[model samples]
Target chain A: MDTLNAGSVSAMLPSAFPIVDKDWELADTYTLHFATDGAFDFDPGQMVMISQPGVGEVPISISSNPDVHDRMSLTIRGSGSVTRALGRLDYGDVVGIRGPYGTPWPLDTAIDQDLMIIAGGIGLAPLRSLIYRALARRSDFRNLTLLYGSRDPQSLLFERELHEWRGRFDMEVEITVDRSSPEWMGEVGLVTSLVDRARFSEADAVAMVCGPEIMMHFVGIALTDKGMHPDNIFFSMERNMKCGIGLCGHCQLGAEFLCKDGPVFSLSRIEPLMKVEEL
Target chain B: MAHIIDIDGLDGLIASLKAEFDVIGPIVRDGLIRYGPIGSVADLPRGWTDVQEGGSYRLEPGNTEALFGFVLGPDSGKTNLFPPRAPMWTYREGSFSATPDSTRPMAIIGLRACDLAAIAIQDEVLLNGPYVDSHYAARRSQLFIVAVNCTTFATNCFCTSMNTGPRLESGFDLGLTEVLDDHHFVVHVGSEAGASFLAGLDQRQATSDELAEADQLIDITANSITKRLDTTDIAQFLADNLESPRWSAIAERCLACTNCTAACPTCFCTSPVDTTDFDGSAARERVWDSCFSLDYSYMGGDPVRSSGSSRYRQWMTHKLGTWIEQFGTSGCVGCGRCITWCPVGIDITEEMAAMRAEVLAKEAR
Candidate 1:
């Protein structure tokens, strides 16, 4: 019976922010950076509902490092009308930004545990933020390793950051591609194949994975087969959501509202529903 | 304090209230009694009774001239509180702004016990969550309820099974029950506003005998409903039987036409639809969307629940099973609107029994 307060009702409206910079990973995918107006802080792995005023809205995970406040970024693929509209925007062209919402990676739990990260295609966007945080406290985490893959040598995202992390002595980085070019000297295979070479403490290891739905499922089995504890393995779940909160039912996966309870869930938590087809 | 008011006094009360607030009540339209704005006492559906069962609703002439001679109609009080289409906000002239609250101070008449429970469930879904829905909050802030206790039953009614009805316990401004045999309504003033409104209307203090009659009448309604649904471990039962063959059986008849969800008062799922004008004005409104819709479960490519069996499973399991995990309460009030409005007579209670029967048969082996 609690009624609305004396003030006006709060609407879920996004403020238009000017795109300060843009980075292209490929012809169809890019990332837009913005300067935040005020104090807006979010944990890694959280997403924002990016909108083109007249086009539409799409939920995109925040890719920029969480350590830096006052600056935000969303790496979007020009796959749909709304994203296409956002992709066309350049320096100073404004787009509405609505959140930094959803649960973040369990970085606190992974402390002192050997960390293994797996990402495919644009899936590295959210994990990229986590990687930055993990590297910031490198001594706190033991044996940090990242295994990443893409469709081809030409399509890997964050090429500059990948090169930087690859050269670091503290972290081990392995990259692969489904279809390789003649000039490509790195490993050429599905990301799961790279799991055979990556090493971690099997008894006290934590793995964070993100990719296509089917890819995540197979990678989960691969991680478990590699002796990683099922409970310690986490992956992200995606669904089309209109209202970034729990009200919109589009993002439902069985008992989970991916928008709120998680877009990130432990493998053990959703394994049953994932086994059931079309749940 | 409860007061006794005859039909004429009741009419006067409605008239006075109409002049002050926007009063809405049940009206007969398109051969169906639905909630609409009231102009006078004549606007209320009187001298009419409805025969409601699975997939059937027929209005028949009533033997009594009493105003509340009928069971509840299809529209639950949910539409008045959380409307089917609500505009969230608008964007124009280089800025975004919230949709202005244009709703008037309003009163809704003839709210039944089952519908009131549904409203409370929606209140939890929209209000008591991690995020509050301001659109529902605005309209709900200005609502006044005139709850009418059920004195009759439709064949599909099972509020007694859900433990939600036959007598309203709370969440109403004013409570009423027509003692048809005694030709008077005992009004229970539930709020200070209700007491003040009644002071201006014609009414007398109810004698002890009159209050006793009201209690007995409500008791009769509770005892008369024959339909029953056993909710013993229903949540776990449905969850355990996720792949139950009973779902496929129900799906064969379920047209996926969304009639059940549309008639259900507590199905609060919605999807946003945006519109833009040539003058650079654009807005977003959330429309009531059904789980039965093929696109509701879409996750990029083909919909997650493309088959009818999975869609029906999503609807029923979400209502009976998963909702408990989400909101700590089953999302059904047992008003039986889903049963009565379904085109194929798909009854949820009957389906649950069938699923249980299948499990029982397996155990016996």
Candidate 2:
């Protein structure tokens, strides 16, 4: 038996810091940008565990570009107790953070190939980092396309970024709303409807999707129908993750530990499990 | 020459062990044998054998005067290694601090061969995994194990088929084979610590005949195990049969009371719980969690495993199938704790046999 070095064992700890930048606020949702404290480093599509001292920790996607090493951003919706407490934070309020855990989107697979990004509601938060990463190396990829949908115009996140992305000649940006008011002038219906309007070679495109479970399921089907291989399509999955590492049993989907194995997994790998009812 | 000790020398050995470590051994608790701190050598469950079958366990006085007659109980080394509840961290002002309670060095006595295998399985899951469980690591590193070779078999025992038991091969500080008829114990030193511990005790070199007799007793116990699990490619077989109706069939009888997972020697799943005090302080704790629990797979609102069939399927498949992929070994040690402790008499070996038979039947057609 190997003797264990007691000094090596350490528990999960989070530090306190204030939100440096509060970018945008949508219905029950907001984006908080903070300094990385030089310790926090992450790739695009990875998430961090954030918490308020008395409150609990919740896994939130890193919405900022990876190139910006000094700071990171998290887009959150006040759904549960922890998120509700986070929503009440001001620009200088303190919060705790741990990790930049989980596997990132397979960007290398999309290199030199056309990329189609699909997101629904706040699901766009994680993909926002991927978009920035791709744009930073715009000449490396063939084309960039984004199809984003929200509950309505009021629920749309990163409005400025969407407008700027639409104006970019190197990218195709399409927006849709599930329901529209008189002032709303955009496509209306499920996000899957916009998949037909996007132009990309089915054989050469690498699709990345993030959304509600039902939305991702249908979008996956639509992508498959477009002649894209299941292996080429990737989606982010969400579960009640306690520890960002694999020790906690909360984020298990079949044999896979979603926290470490992936929050992002290929459709081919997870399709069978996805079909299983309630799993 | 094999080192052997007379049955009467157990008191001196326990006294020597108690001088440096907290000696823990089997004791009758609530009519069931369990490992607890021993104040003296008398704490050992002498002449007591537990009758174990599917969904049942009963303590009965044995015919022999053997000290280590009991095969196992509901508790294994896992209770002390990976405790049921451990504090991960505590938060007071605005920061979190690790509160890993320093554990006293312990000498766990009367560990069976199957329980030793279970400890190794836990070592892989808790210490060798991508993220090490600090509490388990701290407690496990300080353990001095005294393994007992099995001389008796329960009806639910299948360690012989699992290739984990009836005799201690390795993974112990010291291994002992109790020869009730001969009134002696054949002691095998596995670690230097065990060798040093033996140096302080009254021991004698055993004759070849005495050593051979101890070996034969272990062989008899191994052969006596009527329950068996055919583990030939069993992991892949279970994985392939994820959608098999056998799971639902077993689920009908499985109460999903989580007794199997709780009693399982190698089930290392845990769930984190956060509790807040009235003083505005909070602590995060990781408690022993079972996959059978409805909230085990909770994703905010509803649980992923909504049906008992799915929960049971997850538990069995993870234990017998995916655990091989994750840990390079089967999670089960064939101790039969799950079978004996289960309220509904759901036997894992029986389930596996049914699945295997179904596969063979399908191939025949």
Candidate 3:
């Protein structure tokens, strides 16, 4: 029952411990929660390992903002054992947490440049931090746009936050779902469609992207076609991470260890690894 | 310096080695000779051997009572040096920690010449590469190799084509050549540790005639192997035929089950997984994984090599083509382990020959 605080030494942490916290389902796909002492500092777009006692470990994105507090929050889908166990945890209970691993959004580099954030499905979790960061210092950048898409309306995450964001800044936000209900009145289709529709200066523009792999591929192609430099296009790679550290080669793509080298990488750096099969 | 041990002194030498380090060599396991930790000299597989040819392997009941019986095993000394699973670091509750669990000094008895060549290739990748693997360096530093001259080749073995085995030349602390009537073992000390090791054994110096006998034995062994694959043009052949229809044909047979990688002596690519206890207060663990798995390339939500064809192509290309570009040598030692243990018996040599033939056909047209 020893609670590790900020000053606690690393070697003191137990080998196999869990802090099962309460779970909150965001939309139909996104499930959310914090670790027991989930307040670990993490960069935006970086992930954490979630595991049950006997089952296994799975990589999950920290959906919450690092600037806000010390406690980390994760938005996950109940797809596998760790996620399912994570979904079942009640408030103050415990599960495993082992990261804040991978590179986050380059906030310092985004200064004075146009920012374009593209996200799909749960991919929004990583971009939400960038959105919040940009908006907090909105005057630093010119022309901010956030394009979001998901499978359906029920799958859209952070809807309330997006609504709040729209009201607060002089920014453009577009939300699209693959299929909508009778009340639907917005752009619909794949998220890549928005790439062609949106107008932005490719030069000096830093575009951050996340989402399903297929959608990212198309979006990358579309952005390149639109005169965006591959170097300027940053992507948060999503992979199943077992060790948050670079030692575990699970999240490896070619020479780069995604857990260490990046959760975020420039398109120019990751192009070959992305194209190579089985990485 | 090279010193030869008489047949009678081989047991005493082995006995001394057994007392010092955990002696490991080829032993009978699951109908095959696999390398395992051995406590006694008797644990070595007796009267068992394998013949290796291009994409073919067969167990041979050797009439000679040779303790180190068998061709190159399914695994290599790499398993002992760089294990399938290793924990590099552990993290818990926002704290990071690292612990190194490397191997101590141990003797690997009865190592084949091809596997030794494979280890040399591995050294280039792990030690002499752009980034030195500290774990591999630690384990390799403590290794004591006993290279065994191949009396017979495995069915799928083409080490002669690879210029490795059937006759072992160097890179062993001690070398053995088993002959009928009197089991003669030639000892060559490669390092100071080896010199100190041999000095402890009561073996007399080898005369020039005994050395000639060892060479004759090796020459005979080299000539007995029937299969041969020309590796001179293999790298060029593979590079030229990247998009050839042979890839698809081979892919059709390749199960993508990753048996070849698992059996390969020098295939060191691995992925790690992190796990913690249910309480989240504990640490993280890294486990071993293979490149052939579906999730190896899982970026975002989709895999780049979604099809079996691309996966197979990637595996072979990396082994035969890109490995040279990266490590300055072909990744395969032509030990033929991949062909033998493949559940489908998908012979790499056959695959290469098929591809080469296609290339030839295209050139003719």
Best by TM-score: 1
lDDT of 2 at A264: 93
True contacts kept of each: 0.40, 0.40, 0.10
Which lDDT values do the candidates have, in the order given? 0.85, 0.86, 0.70
Q: How high a TM-score does candidate 1 get?
A: 0.96
Each candidate's interface RMSD, rounded to one decimal? 3.9, 4.0, 9.7
Please give, for residues B1-365, the per-residue lDDT of candidate 1 as tens digits. Answer: 69988877778878877766778889898888798899777888879999998999998889988788888778888777777897777888767877765666678989899988998999888888887888777667677888999989899999998989989888888899988776888999988888888888889999899899898888999999988888999888987888888878898899999988888999988877789999988888778999899878765556878889988998998888888889988899999999999988999999998899899999999
In model 1, the runs with Cα more than 4 Å from the true position are A1-11
Model-by-model DockQ, in order: 0.47, 0.45, 0.11
Model with the higher lDDT, candidate 2 or 3: 2
Off by over 4 Å in 2: A1-6, A9-11, A21-24, A91-93, B362-365
Q: What is the lDDT of residue A234 in candidate 1?
A: 91
Candidate 2 has an lDDT of: 0.86
Error of 1 at A26 (Å): 1.6
For candidate 2, lDDT tens digit of each residue in B257-350? 9898889989887876788898878888788888888877776567878889999988888888888887899888999999999988898898
lDDT-superior candidate, 1 or 3: 1
